[model samples]
Target: MTNPTPGQTVSGTITVAANATDNVAVSSVQFLLDGQPLGNPVTAAPYAASLNTTTSTNGAHTLSAKATDPSGNVGSAAGIAVTVQNPTPPMTCFVLQTSVTARGTGTVQTGAFSTVISGEVLLAFVSMDGPGGAAGQSATVSGAGLTWRLVGRANSRSGDAEIWTATASTVLHNVTARSAPAKGGYAQDLTVVAFEGATGTGAVSTGGAASGAPTLTVTTTAATSLVLAVGHDWDKAVARTLPTGFAMLDQCVDTAHGDTSWSEYTNQATGPAGTPVKIGATAPTSDQWNMAAVELLNSGS
Candidate 1:
């Protein structure tokens, strides 16, 4: 058997594969889950089935295969024990932008703002007004007793933008932003745009890394309903590779100057509980302007 190994945990749809041998030429092979037949018997090699585990109970189950030969002989393999898990609940995300403010000529700026809804996970994007040419200039958004993770970066006609996320409520306080070597020339205006979501009975977790490269990897705690985002400072053409069990949600590219670019990607697929989400970029340089973030929600079961 190639899937649903003994003690393996499964959810959603899973592929099962098996091989059988018999004397006097094998006539057919039949697969079963918990003693129930799965489709019809197979008379050829590479026997397989796509089984949806959502219909079964959220616990242990058994899988077996029986083979019959043309000589009227039959043989069966011992049942493989597997665990079934429930699917994660769907999530809805929204975005809201705040009024703009000036960051002055200093390298660092801090301010406070309130969220549109109470008790929602906030993914804040800070846009800076610019004639911005300062390399490695970055921003941070934080509030509600937690510092948000920087998952994205972009450049707008106004300036540069940094994206951050955290689990908090409506009233955010002491949100801060800082840039290295001070923003030169004209002072830039800063605006906050937030992406929020209500996880009803589910929880959200966020994290990221900024080592100045195209790819970033983050770890998450939720086994299901997992979502992820990766933000890079430069707008180079890049692709995202997700860890197992996660699927792509969206990929975005924004550039203010043709040479400088910012990009972000969203994914819904993640591995089982306690698994680290590894994200990769196609053409990552040793630039220290890249970051990644992840958000996870439970199945609400």
Candidate 2:
């Protein structure tokens, strides 16, 4: 006999196989569950039966096989003890806004904060305000003991700013922002936004040409999970797309130059996990672009 070994746990439909022999000639073989007949006896070699494990109680059960010879002599194999287990429940993950900050800076600036929730991953977004539109300027944001790459940037009349982000598993993070050399101007303003309880990983890519669309791609290790794409550029419209098995959670636009407008677009969808997410956008005014992608591993911890 093979399968459903003693003390093994099983669920759903299971297969049981066995072989029997007799001196006179084996006529039939019968299978039993918990000492009761499983079904009609099998009358051939290589005996096998499909047992619906869901129909059995969620506990220990005994399985045995009986064989009968041409002379009507009967023999039974020792019972195998197995356990039936219930189905596992689905996992859930929560997204929460942790903190926000606004600071003035031309050089490197850092913002230190602690997470309010326990066992929560961290994501921080840093937007830098530049004078002559953030077109020729660049900003870098770092936190959670790791440095974040630029995801997207825009330089419109409404504002001249760039957005950067990073993720970490630590509860406390020190976010820093730095801008490239610029003409003598007013102190640039840096805005910081933090997200909690999200599993995030990201990468950065550069544009090949000076006036064409740049494509950024980031892949995750989780087989299935939530994903986010971030794109940045100067004086260009940005858009993002998830992989086949992933859906968008929420998207927000922030302008840090002049008006500092913030808008959110929320729509949920599902896509494949453990795949790469790609974001493509046009950058007409500047040659540089930064992109980041994050995936949430909601595997019940």
Best candidate (score: TM-score): 2
Candidate 2 at residue 117, lDDT? 31
Regions more than 4 Å wrong, model 1: 1-117, 125-136, 140-163, 166-213, 225-227, 233-266, 284-289, 297-301
Please report, in order, the local distance difference test score of every candidate based on alpha carbons: 0.49, 0.50
Off by over 4 Å in 2: 1-88, 99-114, 127-196, 199-209, 212-215, 236-270, 280-290, 296-301
The TM-score measured for candidate 2 stands at: 0.40
Q: Candidate 1, 143: how far from true, in Å? A: 9.6
Candidate 1 local Cα displacement, residue 122, angstroms: 1.0
10 residues in a row with least lDDT, candidate 2: 258-267
Q: Please give, for residues 223-286, the per-residue lDDT of candidate 1 as tens digits.
A: 5444444343333334444444444433333333222222233344455666665554444454
